[model samples]
Target chain A: MYQLTTVTKRYQRGKQTINALEGVDLTIATGDQLVVQGPTGGGKSTLLQMLGALDRPTAGSVSIDGTDLARLSEAKLTKVRAATIGFVFQSFNLIPTLSAQENVETALVPLGVKPAARRKRAAEALQLVGLGDRLRHLPSELSGGQQQRVAIARALVKEPKVLLADEPTGNLDEDTRDEIMGLLAGLWKDRGLTFVLVTHDSSIARRAPRLAVINNGRLKVTERTP
Target chain B: MFFTYLRRELRRRRKAALVVALGLALGIGLVITVSSVSTGMRDAQDEVLHSLYGVGTDLTVAKEAKAEEGGSAPQRFKIEGREDGEKASETDDRLMPLGGFDNLDDSVVDKVAAQDGVATAVGALALNDIKFTGDFKPGEMKKEEGKPGSGGGPRVGGGGADIETETFTVMGVDVSALSVGPLSSSKISKGANFAATDTEALKAVVDSAYAKDKDLAVGDKVTIKGKKFEVAGIATADTGASTSNVYIPLAQAQKLADADMKGKVSKVYVKADSSDAIPAVKKAISENVDGATVTSAADLAEQVSGNLSTASNLATNIGKWLSIAVLVAAFLLAGLLTMSAVSRRVREFGTLKAVGWRSGRVVRQVMGEAFANGVLGGALGIGLGLAGAWIVSTVAPTLTATTGGEQPGGPGQGGGPGGGGIAQQLGEGAQQSVDIALKAPVTLSVIVLAVVLAAAGGIIAGCFGGWRAARLRPADALRRVE
Candidate 1:
């Protein structure tokens, strides 16, 4: 579980301070599937970064499983991030040089997993994402949908407590988006995992158990449609 | 864990690794080759000096002009200045009352013989411009016989061309008398026991030359300046002081040069009881026999050793500069490879950071990759360097000369002749080359230096690449499409 209390992130640009996140508050619980929806530059990515502990809040506290993000050392935070959070990006973010299986195996590196068992687990994760036969292919050789699936598989390979996906379906076609969404939901349901997804699609937002709309560095809760 | 990272890095950058390895190999190879040849040259010089000079003489005392009543002492002697006041002054000094040269009388010799640590003291005399005539002819003299306005025709067969010869003072010892130090043995082209003190052996050589030419026989006459003496015996001298000299009995030589005036001899050659006694003998001779110069085989050896030290230092410096050049080239090649790898993997590094890998880990991976390539490259380079050294030593002009192969006369020659005579050609080819090879050992040190240099170059290049990769921000890195 994680909570953001009145978070405000500011960037100094010459003589002005740009507010990326302002007075934002949110809470995420175990097994909760929440989607944060906003247009480009609407602070959707910044909010996700704060929730995942990738970026610290500038004005407020972000506590993940009761540990404050602002107080943790960089090394300790890296450990926390590795063990408790997994990331999926719109561009897939799979290492272009590594095979689909190796991209997944990279997530297991910080866990001190042995190479053989890491490969086995990576294969299983890829199979779960319906990419069992594309394990040896590079990201460059894969389509946008398949590459995103590999990214999702890499995110799940480490079995982190929380999965943070920023625009997971932004690069996919409508049919591919539906398929990827189904796979994400299936993983959440089967493993009882917490997922904080950032998307611009209202249709994708309606499928989540909860929806939070962020506008101008501020977040407001909307009714759960599903 | 490190090896796994290293392995992956190598696999990912095989082409770059290959290029670095090849570059290192060429660099190391050149280093080894040059070092080996230089060392070989130094060693050859040492061998020739030992054979020619037998460690050399320790000291040479000659008349100093200051010892004379009213002449300034000259710093050095000049062969063409006998008529100069400097020569007259030096001769006067030898005859001065208080000078050490005057103290070399017979009483002085007896006193030095009685002194502690004194060894056998045989008198010696030295003269230049002596002429010898015989069935055997000397090499053609290059000096001009007469001035243009002298109006004298070149002297013909009776006088023959005046050949300058160096004559040594010889001691009248029996054939069994053992010469000590470097003079114990002689290197002669033909005829054995030519150094014998036995009158019969000496007479035999003299008689044989006389049979072919009347002027060369025992009792036959040869002239030194205007003084003529009956030929007594023919003898060969020791390698140390024999190359340009002929010797006769000490008493005879002194008598011929009028050097026994005041019952004194020109110089004395002292033979130590053993090698260890040489220093003590030299010291006693110096202290007791004031006007005479005392020399030891060991002192000569030290001079040779000093020369060897200088040569080795020069060689080592040359090798270091060459190795530095090689290392720089290797570093440049390695840097280029690293940069290329980094450029290609910008996105990969970003993805790793985004996946929560620390900057340190990414840097470690990059360095690990570089280290792996470096080690492999260094090893291959060392092997190539050794091979190159061998090839160079075998094919190099100086080495080929030392090995007794004939000099390759021109570019068109397929190969040159081979044998010991060829070594003589090498001697004439380059004086410094022979000196360098004669004194130094070439193989082991050169190889070790080359390998170490290559590895160090690699590590430096790797660190540069690692620093660049570690500074990249994940957000910005990910934003790049490629």
Candidate 2:
């Protein structure tokens, strides 16, 4: 479970204040699929980052599993990120030097898994993403769509309670985007994963069980299309 | 976990790691080379001083008159006063001047000889003059015909009427009583046996007469200042005393030099049976033998050893300073390179931070990379420095003229012939060669330290860099086009 109370993130740009997110309050429970949809510069990514514990809100409290994120020490927050949250970046930010399997294994490093078992778990995660044959391939060698799938595999490898994806299919073609979305939806349903996705495309945003529209620095919640 | 991080860091920044290693290698190599050279110089000095001085000498009875005048030639003084005066008068009053003495009374020799730890008591005589012989001159006919001989004649290029010879000192030692062995024999016209005869026989030989320039050899007929005798044998002294001296029986030397007397010996050599006896023996000699100054081999050795040690210390200090300079330069260069590399990796680090990696881990990874580079570079530098030292040593000229050889240049001209110049040059060359050898040993330790420092430095730098990187809001980092 995640909750945000009157969170506001502000930045200073050469003597002027820029409000990236202002007075936003939101919550999501287990198995809930929440999508924050907005145009570029509408604070969708900032909201997702705050929810994922990757960034601290400038002026409010973010609580995950009832632990105030702002109050947690840096090390404790890192542990929280490692144990309870997973992130999927739009660019599929897998290390180019690592093979697809190794990219998945990177998440296990913080878990203190022995190398062999880590590798074993990584390979299994890749298999779940239907990239079993491509485990040894580097991210550069994979197609854009396939790299995103590896990213998804990495996100799921830790089996975190919350899966946060930022424009998961932003770089893919229409057909590949749909395919990735289907794989994500199936995993989310089967594993009862809590999903919080940031996207600009209304079509993709509509697939979520719930949607929140962000305009300026405020959020407007709306029901799912179905 | 540390090793794994190190491995990954090394793999990721292989080039930077290499640079650090090279810097370290250079520093270590230099240290080893310098130390070796310093050690070698010490050993050479020790050998020469030890061989010449022996364990210790009891009484150096230089003539008080000559000591006052500061003449360079060797002199002697007589021991006098009550037998207890030998023990009681610690002052210089007991010394009596005795110059050019060849033999002391047998009773005097026996008296000192009876003292505890007195190994052997022998008299010595020293004389310096030009040596001339037939080999240095031409035959009568050749002299008339104008052919130059091996003889360095005074006349221009003819077995000249007279020959000019270099001034040489003949030091007569009691070969029969010598405790130390000969170092070389080419310069000794007669074998050492010539000096091994009894006192009377030696006296008879020295008292016989012969021609001034007669050629002599083992078994050949010869004479000392007109006293005739058959040559017995020849021998050489140690390098320290090699410049002067032909060894002969003490009686023979006294007879030849016309220096036999009742209460005189050139100097009394006293050996303590063990090191502990030195002080006591010296005390006895000082008390019993007036006008004699006692000295120990340890003191002489220390004097020589000190000179070498000072030189070595200077060299090592110079080397250390040089290494420090190099390390500082290396650190700066490495720091600049690391900073640049980190600048380029800002995005990557930010991604890692975003992916749950801690700032400390990022710093460690960077430092590990630096350490790897340092180790590799240091090994290489060490190899290069040793090779350089070896090559320099091989090509460099000798610093000193070895004993028994003519130094190639004039005295004080480092390039001079048969003088201190050669030894000095050789020493300098050795110093330089060792400087090269030192590169590796010095470089290795330096490199190891440097690399470790560099890694730590890199980590600190990277920590600051990583902290800055981690402070960035992820959305801004991801949104930046560059």
Candidate 3:
């Protein structure tokens, strides 16, 4: 569970202080799926960054399970991200040189998982992502959709409590995007993870149980049935 | 995982790695070659000094020849059975002490030997044998110029006369103390060495070149100042040139020299107790022994000239600076290239960091990659350095070293019958030189230095790249919106 109290994030662009996020309060319980929608440069990603523990708010506190994340050390925040949060990027940011299996295995490395167990778990995760036969394929050798599947596998392999994704299908075709969304929806429903996704697509937001619309560093939320 | 990532990254950027490695290799190869060649130059210089000063002799003591009043006197030849206006043929051989070095009292040896740090001192007399044969007719006497000792006597001129001259050097040795003088660097190529008891036995050691020139061997008789002495041995100098043509007992040489040289020696060879004692010993001798100039091996080395000296200077000066500059450039090049490599992998590093990789871990990965490149470069550099040294040792030209000596006598000075004056002969006597083939010997220390430099180069490049990787914020991954 996450709680944000009047979180405000600011950026210094030259001499101008740009407000990336204004005073905003929000709450998310465990297994809740939230979709954030906005136009480009609308502070959608900034809010997600604060929620992911990737950046700190200028004012107020972001607490996960009553532990204030804004007050934790950089190292502790990294531990939180490693053990409790997983992130999927828009570009399917798989290491270009690593094979599919090796790419998935990197998430387990910081967890101190033994090599044998790490390898076995990585293979099992790839199998769950329907990429078991493509384990040795590099990102360049895989299709765009297949690469995104590998990224998804890398994220979920650690079994984190939270999954933060930014534009998960922004670079894909409609068919590929729907396929990846379906896979993510099924995994989220089965795993009961606290999922926060940022996107500009209204169709993806329509499937969420709750939607948050952010524009010019301000936010508004509404509850809806999927 | 670290090794696997390092190996894969290195493989992906093998071209960059090779460029860095080759740059380092060039610097390392030049360093090794220059070092080896410098060692060769030192060895050659030692050989030259040993040939001049002889083995076991750390220093030498000699007095510079002082100028005589009204210049040197002209040579006079006495011809028996000579009639006025009639042609006469005569031959004369004058065995006199060499002119450049004046005689020092025999007690100077004892004075030098008694100095602190002086192990022992032995005296040697250097002489020149001038044999002249000519046919001439006595001409009318004329009043000479205002030079001292120019007697208006029968001047041999105006007649068909030809004079032939032959000159060879001779060194008188202390038979009992031969281990510290010119003979120490020579080996008896044929015949036996001088026995300790042959101090005044009228026996002589002949140089191989002189012996070969005169068709003389051991058991053959050599005449000096009309006195015949049996040749006891033929000595071959370890270096290219021998110190003298013949060696006789010191007492016998004093007997044959002028009356003033009766109980004197031209040179005193001194051996110090240790190399570190040479400066003190030289100082002691210079302070105590009046009119004596002390010369150490280091002083002699400074006088060495020709290709060996030039090569030594080049190796130490230009070669050293060039290697240093190239090494610095190589290090900088490697650092910049590694930093550039890290810059290109920013997205990848940021992704890793966002996936819960600590900044320390990311830095280690960059460092590992750079270090691997460095190690690979080091191995290749060693191979290149060894090959360079081998090529130098095998193909370098022979280097010649000439000792600095006094200028040859000017024309019309000490005018002889038909030859240059005795002063010119003496000047030639001091100019001894030898040719040495250069050999570059690779030592363990040079290889160790190369290894250390290689590792240092790698770690330095790693630091450059790792600092950049460690500074990347994990938010940059999603912030870039790629």
Candidate 4:
């Protein structure tokens, strides 16, 4: 479970200051998939960064599974981020030199996975995303859909509690976008893990059981499926 | 994990890393070149000193004769078993410190030879002021200018050399020790040595340099002091300041220089069987020969021979400073290169920090990369040093006391390939060859030192790079998003 109370994030560029996020209260239950829809510069990415422990809020308290993120040391916060969260970026962010399998294995590296087991686990993770045959392919060698699948495999390899994806399928075609959406829905349903995705597409938001729209650094819920 | 990152990183940025490695190599190469030359010079100095001191000659015995009151009337004698009336023999020759002009009795050689610990005693007339037959005048010849390594160490045969004024260090020895005594180290480059048994042939064994200058060879007859001598052989010796250019029988040198000096040797050099017998033999010689001064090789190197001492000092001190300067430059060059690399890889390092890698681990990864550069740089430095040393040595060998000491009535004075000046008035001089051997002083110790220094330079650079990487904030780094 994730809880945020009166969260405010500010960005200062030289003399002028911009409020990226302000006065936001949000709660995410365990095993819940929430689709957050927002216009450009509405601070959805900032909210996700705060929730994932990648950034600290200027004001307010953020607690994940009962521990306050603001009170944790940098080292402890790093451990929390690695252990409890998975991140999927819209751009894929795969290291060009590494193959699809190595990209997945990178997540397990910090977990101190042994080489033989790490390789086997990485292959299995790729196979879970229907990319077993593309295990040895570099990111550049894969299609946009296949590349996003490799990114998803990397995020899911460690089996984290929360998956924070910022426009995960925003760069894909409509057909490939639907394919990635199906994969994420399948993983969340099968593993019973919480998935929070930020997107501008209303079609992406309509597919989620819970949905919210962020505007001017404020959040307003559209609906929550009973 | 650090190793894996290091290997891949280095391969990816090999061009940049090679720039840093090559910079370090020049510094190490310079150190090697300077050290080898310095080391080579030191060895040559030792050789020259050893030769002048003579082989197996533990003690050199010479009769010291002079008056305390500045007059010849009063003399001091320290002979152990001596009569009360006997006075010291004094000579007017100030340049010859070995008392070559003082006609000591022939019985002194016998007395020294008969000592208990004395292995063999050879008496010689060390006449340094003897003139040769070629020079036209005294003041006409100055040092030849613009020659490589022309001036250094002590000048051979003292400082007052006039190339036009024919002069030679005439060391008339007992012919037996010519090949067995001090001259034994003299390698004969072209011809053989004069027969040790041949007593009186008035034959000369010339220095190879002198032979070349004079166009002299075996069976060639040359006249000095109205008497002609056949050139017997050409040989080389390692005599630095005391290098003798002419060697003849003791009897002949005595006859040519002074008819009244027969059966009188200026110095008797005694060789002990071993180092242990040196003190005993010295004691015996001191007791038997009155007013004799005995010197060993170590004493000759330290107390005497200014040229040898100067050469040794230059070799040891100069080389050390040169190596240090190069090492400092190597460190700075490598540091600058690695630091630049750190700045360029800002995003990469930041990403590493963001991905659950600790600050220490990131620093270690950077340091490992620097260490790899050290390995490559060290190998290149060693190879470059060796090759550079060889080239420098081949082109122009460094001057030692022996090779540069002789300025002469030089080996280039007469003959000039076709022969010019006729043989002049009667004088005594030796024609022993001048042999100088130059080699690169690249020892195992020097190689190890070069490698260690190069590696240390890399480590220092790595530390700086690590420090810079460690200071990077992961959040700020991740903001770059590259």
- Candidates' DockQ values? 0.31, 0.38, 0.68, 0.27
User: Which of the numbered candidates is closest to the native, going by highest DockQ?
Assistant: 3
Alpha-carbon local distance difference test for all models = 0.60, 0.57, 0.84, 0.69
In TM-score terms, candidate 3 sits at 0.86
lDDT by residue for model 2 (A14-130), tens: 999879899998888888899888877788877877887777889999998798997888777778777778888888887776789888887887778898998899999999989
Candidate 1 Cα misplacement greater than 4 A, ranges: A12-17, A133-143, B1-5, B11-15, B18-131, B134-340, B383-392, B398-442, B473-482
Q: For model 1, what TM-score is found for chain B?
A: 0.49
lDDT of 2 by residue, B255-350 (tens): 555334334445445445666776777678668865555555445444343334455455568765776676566655655666666666666565
lDDT (Cα, tens digit) per residue for candidate 1, span A94-189: 766678998899888888899899999999999988899999998889999999999999998988899988888888999999999888888888
Top-down lDDT ranking? 3, 4, 1, 2
Off by over 4 Å in 4: A5-25, A37-42, A55-60, A212-223, B1-4, B40-125, B128-185, B188-234, B238-242, B245-344, B396-440
Single-chain TM-score of chain A, each candidate: 0.96, 0.97, 0.98, 0.97
Q: Which stretches of model 3 miss by more than 4 angstroms?
A: B72-79, B82-91, B134-162, B175-179, B184-205, B215-221, B226-239, B249-263, B306-311, B386-395, B398-400, B409-441
Candidate 3's error at B194, in angstroms?
Answer: 4.3
State the interface C-alpha RMSD of candidate 2: 3.0
| Tens digit per residue, CA lDDT, model 3, B156-188 | 545556777777666788899988987887889
lDDT top scorer: 3
TM-score of each: 0.63, 0.65, 0.86, 0.66
Instruction: State the displacement of the C-alpha of residue B335, model 2, in Å, after optimal TM-score superposition.
Output: 2.7
lDDT of 4: 0.69
